[model samples]
Target: MTSMSKSKTNNGNGTVDSRRQEVQRIVKNACDQLNSEGVDARNYVEQLAWLFFLKAFDEAETRREEEAAFDDAGYERRLSGNFAWSSWASKTDHPDEMLEFVDGKLWIKLTSPDPKKGLGDDPLAERFRR
Candidate 1:
């Protein structure tokens, strides 16, 4: 059987890097576990990409709020409800509900053609549109 190779990185100053190892270990574990349950490896990776995109966008929205970049009231009103990652991803009361949401409303918003409304020209949303 093949062994998982340890990940390496350099600080550009020639040193053993542990950061890469941690991320590699995390991803390897997730993929291994998911694949064992008959999940296609590629699909698992794609779903992970979606999650990372949402988390990153949520963070960016928070930054924009702090900077007063968007219409404050409007921004809060837009995301503070079911539209926010926290609500659909973490705070959902049931697993099935979250699944329905991820495949439904979330998908719709990311792919919304009305650029002036949902996600509105956001590059990350475009990445998740598929």
Candidate 2:
């Protein structure tokens, strides 16, 4: 029988690399979609933050529901009307106010360590920083 050589593998490092690539891919896709929709390419970073915040909020809510019985009051308490892009955009006729609302939510989500309804650590915070 021929001798077999074993190849060493770094699963942990591979996992990290995989995750990094996945995040990059997601950001790229989001940017592409935004561009296709006629949004300014420069706004990709802002859009990324907004999408990330929405996704994180949805995931956190799902987790909460699975972990505990559904609580309408708790759900309502955690809801952030500002999370809705269209709603926030319409809040003020001025572009500055719209940008402010979006930026404010982005900052809150990025800084919060704990899951708070509309608040949580932004998953795309790293991308935004870059």
Candidate 3:
């Protein structure tokens, strides 16, 4: 990661390269935690990537809320309530909870229709469904 550039993000909290490294580090930690539970390294990384995608989507929604440019702002917030990364991803205290949410419930939602959310034919939603 040190070999990567250190250009700062718009937030100025950290460099773009550093932020990617941080995500990778988090994914590694997640992989380590799940490996003991019989999850394969490759699959764990995939799971982490999916979760990160959700986090990014949720962040975009939050950004829209903070900077409301239109009535349709934050409309891309597909995941809400428990399914959102803010709820599941933020649960770092109990490692088992994170693992259970990602490994169990996450898969079911990803493949099935979320009755609570009526985001029909949404591109992101459709991708998750498949």
Candidate 4:
């Protein structure tokens, strides 16, 4: 993951400090909501970690894809379609569908050792297996 110091997101208007505050506010709200639903701090944090990791992975892949396009080279994505965060997580209006996809297909692809069922033999897939 890139360092926050190296890259500051202004969200197209606000300063870095304001963006930080906005993120903190969002996180606090999410924590409060999860607490009300009986999810402990540790559990919610763990789930958030998975989300953040996937988002970062998607961002990195996007960067690589752009570079490949600029260089006129072929770049195959590690994940695509419903397995990608862009394909699944971006559709916030369909929470039920997103949840079903995550539980039904995404988890299977990430965890299944059978190459036909999972991410094949990539280094990232090997790490997931561990």
Measured on C-alpha atoms, candidate 1 has an lDDT of 0.67
Lowest summed lDDT over 10 consecutive residues: which window, candidate 3? Answer: 1-10
lDDT of 4 by residue, 1-22 (tens): 4666445552354575686788
Which consecutive 10 residues in model 4 have the weakest lDDT in total?
Answer: 5-14
Q: How close is candidate 2 to the true structure, as a TM-score?
A: 0.36
Model 1: how far residue 43 lies from native, Å: 1.9
- Reference-based TM-score of each model: 0.60, 0.36, 0.59, 0.75
Candidate 2 C-alpha lDDT tens digits along 79-108: 345554434545556878767765777456
| Per-residue lDDT of 44 in model 2 | 71
- Top candidate by TM-score: 4
Report how far residue 47 has shifted in candidate 3, in Å: 1.4
Error of 3 at 22 (Å): 2.9
> Compared with the true structure, what per-residue lDDT tens digits does model 3 show for residues 2-115?
323333333465566677888789767867778889988766566666766777888887777667656654454456678777788777899898888877987677666555
Better of 1 and 4 by lDDT: 4
Shift in Å, residue 86, candidate 3: 1.3
lDDT of each: 0.67, 0.58, 0.69, 0.79
- The full ranking of all candidates by lDDT, starting with the best, is 4, 3, 1, 2
